[model samples]
Target: MKAKERRNNIKNLLINSSNPIKGQELAEKLGVTRQVIVKDIALLRAEGKKIIATPEGYLVTKNQENLITKIIAVSHNVEDIQDELETVIKFGGIVKDVVVEHSVYGEIKAMIMIKSLYDVHNFMKKINKGKGEPLLVLTGGIHLHTICADNDEIMDNILSELKNKKYLIY
Candidate 1:
């Protein structure tokens, strides 16, 4: 296939996939190397495709009609981090990212990319084993998470639960 045709096919496949498309998978489909696939993705991005490369893989933003995203402010004891994320996930919200107010760096943001209990557990375990200290403990358990859902009601339900537990800020 020609370069332009391959690039277009890659873009279309990514745009339709609900999950991340790995470079290897894309290359296998195109009969090319993963390096070529990566370059094609870069070229597609330069052409204004909103492709997000993540640890899992690359995903096109799925901006469907019912998509709703919001940043929820939450406060908790550092030890309750798992409980907080579990609550969010149980209520159907994907914890996409975390943001914290820094003393010198202004607002600092990190992608949590947590969508399930397993992800939360693995993340905490890695932190415990690799890091000197958990980052959440530095902020007194006060943080913001960007969550996404299919409707406003899911977020409302999650926020209501947060408020009930005194975790919601305003």
Candidate 2:
């Protein structure tokens, strides 16, 4: 298939699928190298496609008309990461991203997109396998998360749970 046709197919696939599609999977489907898919994704983004690269794969950003988004400050030890994420998901919140203030960079953010226990497990596995440090380490375990939920009540419940666990910064 031509490059333009392949990109259009990719866009269609992303739009129709709810889950993030891995580059390797896309490459296999397109009979191309994973690098090609990466480049295609970059080109798509250049054209103003709202594609987000999550740990699992690539997905188009969905409209948030009915969702409530809030930034919450949290602090916890590295070991408590799972519990913190679980609390948010349990209260119906999707942890969209984690942000931290960096002395040099000012602010750094990572797309988390953790919405379930499965996502949390995969996230922790990736971190452990890569020996990756959480961005919270940059600021002594203090960070902010952009969480989205069905409504204000769900977000409030998430915050209440985090507060009970002493994870909320305030």
Candidate 3:
């Protein structure tokens, strides 16, 4: 894999993982050298990924310094996905993750990490072109998004906008 794609994969793995992952484990998982993993870690850190080296291994911080997060319930049809994501991005909120409660499985979550309109468009294209179905379909368009911002003001603005757009639930 290319360095950029590999770094993105590394970020996705770290973001989705609930536990720390050792460098060697990452290396083996990505079919690269341990040294490459180490360099990728450094590059990711330089790019403000909030990756910290723990005694166990490397763990991506869910709550970074000065970052405020809010989970909001929303219900919208699949066709409105881009509009919903664009709304969040326009308000300066980072789309951190999506969560849905399943009747049989309980809470199911996926890391989105969408920070810009480009990312949102890419996500929409991937979903539209591929067979990958959105988790919201399993929950009748009702779901939750973990939005992050540098402060509460931005978050409040996002919530208000979503509410005005009829995306926010309650």
Candidate 4:
């Protein structure tokens, strides 16, 4: 395929992807190296594509009407993280990202990619196995999570549950 055609194809792939598309996959489809695909994505972004780079891959944001995002402050012991995530999902919210204030790095954000209890459990397990500390613990059990939902009612319910569980800091 010509370079222009390849770039166009990559754009189409990214636009249709609900989640991040791996560079390797793109490269394989275009008979090029992953680096080339990365460059192509960069060029596409430079041309005004709303693509978000994530740890897992690159994803194009969905153009939906009435998309709302809010950050909720939450706190919990290591053991309660799962419960917190479950509550968020139960209330129809996606725990989009986690933010922590680092002493030297300032505020650090990580994409959690959690929308279900299964994701929560696996994330906790990985952290446990790695013996890594939660960012909230570093900040004295205070952390913020960016969440997305259809409306404010979901957030209200999540806040209520977090409060009941003593996960919401005063």
Candidate 5:
């Protein structure tokens, strides 16, 4: 009912959620407007919460303690987007984000947080539903993805698969 209480509730929801929660979904659950959710998120961040706004929605960044995180360079057309994402997921890697380098804008990144086949499907669907081009389009189909896995074997296998599929950039 109050601003402080609402922000606490927002943090609780993010902590318990396994998947990203859309702003609208949060607003609906909290009986507030989407703008309020946005403001709450900003305020939460100001409080040093690890809430990350991904393309799918809002997620609290998990601890990478003892986890292996690596960045992979890849190149592919928009149509191969699903396949590339699927490959990473297939090899037990969590696609954390996509990064691109623009000549004028330097480097830009976005949180993807793709962890499953369903996530891959949902990401592709959203891209198709929107008119905006993938970030790779800005750099001629070249980009990087930060992936996380449990061990070296999984990371090695993911890299091998991406390389085999011609998506991995040497």
Candidate 6:
């Protein structure tokens, strides 16, 4: 298929799917390398597509009318990453992204899109296998997460849980 045609197919697939689609799967369907799919995703994003790359795969952002977003500041050792995530998910919060403040770069952020325990497990596995430092390492475990939930009560519960676990910065 032509590049434009392939990209259009990818967009349609993402739009119609409820879950993120892996690049390898897309590549297999299109008879191209995973790298090509990645490039196509980038190109699509460059053209203003709302393609979000999560640990699970690529997904188009959904518009949920009642969803509320909040930025929470957290501080903890790397070992507590799982616990922190679980606390949020347990309180019906979806982790949207992680943001860290860098002395040189000011602020850096990455999409996490962790909504369930399964996503947490996969994210932890990817981190361990790559052995790469998390963005929180830049600031002594101090980072921010943008969390989404159904209402303010859920966000408050998530904050309370993190505070009880000594993970909330304030």
Q: What TM value does model 6 have? A: 0.87
lDDT of 3 by residue, 1-170 (tens): 89999999999999999867889999999999999999999999999889876434677987656788788899999998999999989988888778999999999988777778877887888888875898899999999998888888888998889999999999
Of 1 and 2, the candidate ranking higher by TM-score: 2
Candidate 1 lands at a TM-score of 0.69
Q: Please provide TM-scores, in order, for all candidate models, with all chains considered together.
A: 0.69, 0.91, 0.66, 0.78, 0.91, 0.87
The CA lDDT of each predicted structure is: 0.80, 0.92, 0.87, 0.79, 0.92, 0.91
- Per-residue CA lDDT of candidate 1, range 111-166, in tens? 66677887788767866676545555668878898888777888888888878888
Clash count list over all predictions: 0, 0, 0, 1, 0, 0
lDDT of 2 by residue, 4-95 (tens): 99999999999999899999999999999999999999999999998989878999988866799989999998889999999999987899
Higher-scoring candidate on TM-score, 2 or 3 = 2
Better by lDDT, candidate 6 or 2: 2
Clashing pairs in 6: none
* Cα RMSD, model 4: 2.8
Model 1 residue 134 distance off true place after TM-score fit, in angstroms: 5.1
Q: Candidate 2: lDDT of 82?
A: 93
TM-score of 5: 0.91
Instruction: Candidate 1: list runs displaced more than 4 Å.
Output: 1-13, 16-18, 21-43, 131-135
Deviating ranges (above 4 Å) for candidate 5: none
